[model samples]
Target: MTHDHDHDHHDNDLDPMAARVRALETILTRKGLVDAAAIDAIVETYETKVGPRNGAHVVVKAWSDPAFADWLRRDATAAIASLGYAGRQGEHMQAVFNTAETHNLVVCTLCSCYPWSVLGLPPVWYKAPPYRSRAVLDPRGVLAEFGLVLPEGQKVRVWDSTAELRYLVIPMQPEGTEGWSEDRLAKLVSRDSMIGTAVALAPEAA
Candidate 1:
C-alpha cells in the first residue's frame, strides 16, 4: 500500500468533530463559500505529494545508516529536521522503533494532533472518535482493522500525539535488502508503516 497509499479504507462519521466538519463542508459547498473540488485537490496533494515521500526517505535513511538511526533515537526532531522535513505541526517529534517483540501505534484521543509535516494530513479515520478511543483501549484490535494482526506475544505500544508533541513509528526494515540502496529501500516504506498501523512493505510487495 503506497501513504501506504490508502485513504478510502473507511468513511465513518464516528465523532462529533468529524461529523461537524462534514456538516460544515456540506453547508459551505451549498452556499458556494468553498469549492469542494479545490478542497479535494488540497487533501490529495497532502496525501500523495507532501508527507509520505519525505517520511519514506527518512525511514530509508534510518534503515541504511546506523549513525543516523542512533541520532534519530536520541533526538527525533533534530534527526528529522536534518533531512529538511521539519515544519509546522511537526516541530516536536519522537521516533519509536519497532522490533521483533514490539510494535508501535499512534493516536490523538483528544484531537487529531498529528505530525503533518512528516505524515502529511492525518487520515479521516485517525481523526474520528472511534479510532481515537479504540486505539488506546484496543490497540491490537485497531491494528487488526488496519489489516495488521501482530503476533500474540508482540507488545503493542500506543502513543498519544498531543498539541506539543507527535510520534513517528519506525517500522522494522524489511529483510534481504543488504545490498540495496536507500532509494530502493524507500520503495518498501509505506506511510501506514510509519503511522504504525501496518508493517513496512515486503520486497516482493514493493
Candidate 2:
C-alpha cells in the first residue's frame, strides 16, 4: 500500500482517503450532524496519526544539544533521523534558520502546508486565507500582530512552502540554561517555537 509517485504532477491525483473525507463531510452536512463530535474525530485522525509529533521530537532534540541543533539547522531530515523521527513529509524537510540576521517564516500558499510530523494539525487561523495571503506579503507586520516583535536590528526572511519539502523554525535557546541536560532542556521547548510564534525559554527564565 506504499504508493510512491515518480512524477511531481502525480501528487495532484485524488487521494482516495481524502476523497472519502469529502464524501463523509457531504454525508454529515446532508444529515445535519456536522457538529463538535464530527470535528473532534477529524482532529483526532490527524493528531494521532498524520500530524507533527515526529517533528516535535526533532525540535526537542535540537533544543537540548547545541551540536545537534547545528546539525539539524544544516540538514534537518538527516539530523532528525539521527534521533529517530523520520517518516512521511519529514523525510525531506529543510530546517530554515530564524536568527538575528535573517528570520524565517512558513505558510502554505495553496493550503496550510506544515511540518505535521512535529507540529501537529495547523491551528484554524493558519489555514485562514488572510494569514496565507498576508504573512508572505508582510511578515514583519504579521509577526508583530502575533506579538513577536523582533529587535530593531534583525532581518526577516519569509519562506512560502510547497508540498515537496516542509519547513520548521529552530528558535534560539534561552539564557540561564548554562549546564542543563538534554532531557531538562527538551521540556523547555514548545510547539510554538517549531511553528514560529514564541521562542524557547530556559527553566530558570520560565
For residue 201, what is the lDDT in candidate 2? 62
Instruction: Candidate 1: count the clashes.
Output: 3
- Tens-digit lDDT track of model 1 for 130-177: 999999999988999899999889999999988889899999988887
Q: Which ten residues in a row have the lowest lDDT in candidate 1?
A: 1-10
Inter-residue clash pairs, candidate 1: 1-4, 1-5, 2-5
| lDDT for position 165 in model 1 | 90
Root-mean-square deviation of candidate 2: 13.0
Q: Pick by TM-score: which candidate is best?
A: 1
Q: Model 2 over residues 38-114: C-alpha lDDT tens digits?
A: 68886786757654455556766675667988898788778876765554543477787667776667788898787
Best by lDDT: 1
User: Each candidate: what lDDT?
Assistant: 0.87, 0.73
